[model samples]
Target chain A: MTDFLYNYLHVYLFVALFMLFCGIVGVVYRRTLIGMLVSLELIMNGAGLNLVALNRFVSPENAYGTAFTLIIMGIAAAEAAVALGIIILIFRKYRHIEGGDLREMRD
Target chain B: MNFAEIIFLFIIAVTMGGAATAVLAGSVVYAIMGLVVTMFGVAALYVYLNSPFVALMQILIYVGAVTVLIAFAVMLVGPLYRRPKEWTTAGKFGAALGVALVSLLLFVRFVTETFPRAGAPSFEMTTKDIGRLFFDDLVLPFELISLLIVVAILGAIMLALFARGNK
Candidate 1:
């Protein structure tokens, strides 16, 4: 446990896997669009951490991995904006944002 | 693990717990708060990786912008705090089994693949190196990414406007 924790890679990998687990659970259990969006962000952040970790430890000079992580953040910001707008629209039209209850498009 | 490793491990544990709580908590607001803690942990990890610039950016972009946006969305949308009466058994079981199995597999892979590649640690790839790379080999993509961010912002605004007008 001591050796594992001291090493930088261990912390990085642990965080990634743990975040991924949280994301999966959030996806499975969350009923609101906002909650789901939060989960999605968790997933993206996990991936971003992985990129930074790999870049730092294994391939420091390349810098592509870190750059990609930033790009992912950019994408996530845009995604959140658009998703929130859609969620609002859904709420305005249907009066609720519950994933289970908002089954209007089931056809 | 050494004393330093132990301390870091403690931090990592807290981070994971916070992340789990953020996603699985009953209230949407608490979940978002948990996400803030998780973001802090990720930033810490960035620091551990020898990139204070990325760590600062992580905090600024994720903790500042993203968390604020999520909070705003939660406030504007109703039912965010209203707890559902019940979750189906299937939902609970599936999520539990899913996380357990995935974590288990990942642990195995982690143990197996980690030992062989314990290469020597290199220089502290400091902020200067990052800036150099940003201007040198990575110039084009860096500019393109900014453009993509702009497009995403515009598209989001357009969608919101269109949805409002239709309603």
Candidate 2:
């Protein structure tokens, strides 16, 4: 069992894919801004997982995967900060953060 | 199952369970808590993949910083009456679940068939090597990312202050 896991790349790939799917579903199904943000983080993580897995199982010589994943983490942190800031601002303006109520541009 | 496999399985379960909770939980606070679990589990998976440095950063940045930021956002938004807003109808829920399942099955089949089963040779990637790569090969992007963070911090503060002023 250990060998099957540590020796196989597909396992990690499958897990990452599952995570991405979950994130997509969450994004579509969620109504609130914060909930959607959380799902977006999940999707980012899934991508990071896939990158590291491919790095480990496809190209072990270079530290490219790890570095790339670090870059992704940085980007995700910035995204979360900006997103939360926007959410806070929206809440202050509208007094609520529901998706349905954010239809100001609708004619 | 050997010790390592058991641990791997456990980590996967935790990761998936946490993600499920984060997405499915009714309360936003509970969803953030579940996100914490999922972040830690992903960090653990990084360790298993032989990148302990990334794992540590994952824990530090994601579990420590990002989760705290989210929690603060939740607190700032004030108390919320747990409303069944996300999945208001059973039909919507069922449709989303059906799409997720179908996509998952297709992805699994494509990956298993296309990707070669023979794993690449393993190698130890020390923190020093990662640092060297960051400084040497990825210096430009690294510096740019740092700049991005600085800008983001300033923007967040400005936006918050502006919002307060408008009130």
Candidate 3:
């Protein structure tokens, strides 16, 4: 069991995949903009996990994958900031942040 | 199982449980708290994967900054008292479940078939290595990320100011 825990690469891969799955479910089922944003962060996290896992198991010598993961973090931070700003602006305009109520352009 | 394996299993449980709570919780603040839990679990996993620097950054940027920002946004938006509308009906839920299961099976099959079972060789990844790489080989992207953060900060401030001016 310990060997299985330490030696297997597929376990990490599956964990990352599961994170992606949960993120997708959240994205589809969530009704609020903030919920969707949270789900999106989960997706980004899944991607980061995949990168680090592959980097560790496949090529530990090169720092490329780690660097990429760092960059992803940077981008995720910026994205969250921008997304929150947009959410605030939306609340200011619409008076609510429900995903359904922003249907002014639907017509 | 050894201590390390037990700890790893615990971390996995924490991660999955936190993610479930983040998705299934009714309150947005509770969801954000779940996200913080999930972030900490991921950071612990990073340590197991031998990337302590990334782990630290994950905790710092994610739990430290992003979650706080999200919490502040939830507060700024005021109380969301109305029950969130169920966007996915039973039929949609079934469809989504089917798609997720199929994709997961396909990915598992692809991975098992494509990759060899040889274990990863252990190697040390010091903070020094990460720093040197950032400054030497990956300098341009590093600089670009700084620029991106500056732009994002300015844009967020501008957006908030614009909204205030509209009042």
Better by lDDT, candidate 2 or 1:
2
Clashes of 1: 2
- 1 or 3, which is superior by lDDT? 3
Candidate 2 residue-wise lDDT, A1-107, digit = tens: 33567668887887788788878778878878888899899989989989998898888999898899999999999999999999898888877777767977221
Q: Whose DockQ is greatest here?
A: 2
Chain B TM-score by candidate, in order shown: 0.83, 0.90, 0.90
Deviation of model 1 at B7, angstroms: 3.2
When sorted by DockQ, best at the front, the candidate numbers are: 2, 3, 1
Query: Given candidate 2, what's the lDDT at residue B39?
Result: 89
- True interface contacts retained by model 2: 0.72
Alpha carbon lDDT at B124, candidate 1: 72
Q: Against the true two-chain complex, what DockQ does each candidate achieve?
A: 0.50, 0.70, 0.65
Instruction: List the candidates ranked by lDDT, beginning with the highest.
Output: 2, 3, 1
Which regions in candidate 2 have their CA more than 4 angstroms from the true location? A105-107, B82-86
Docking quality tier of candidate 3?
Answer: medium
TM-score of each: 0.87, 0.93, 0.93
Task: For candidate 2, write residues B7-85 as lDDT tens digits.
Answer: 9999999999999988898888888888899989899989889999899999999988888988888888757764555
Local error of candidate 2 at A83, Å?
0.5
Against the reference, the lDDT scores of all candidates come to 0.76, 0.86, 0.85
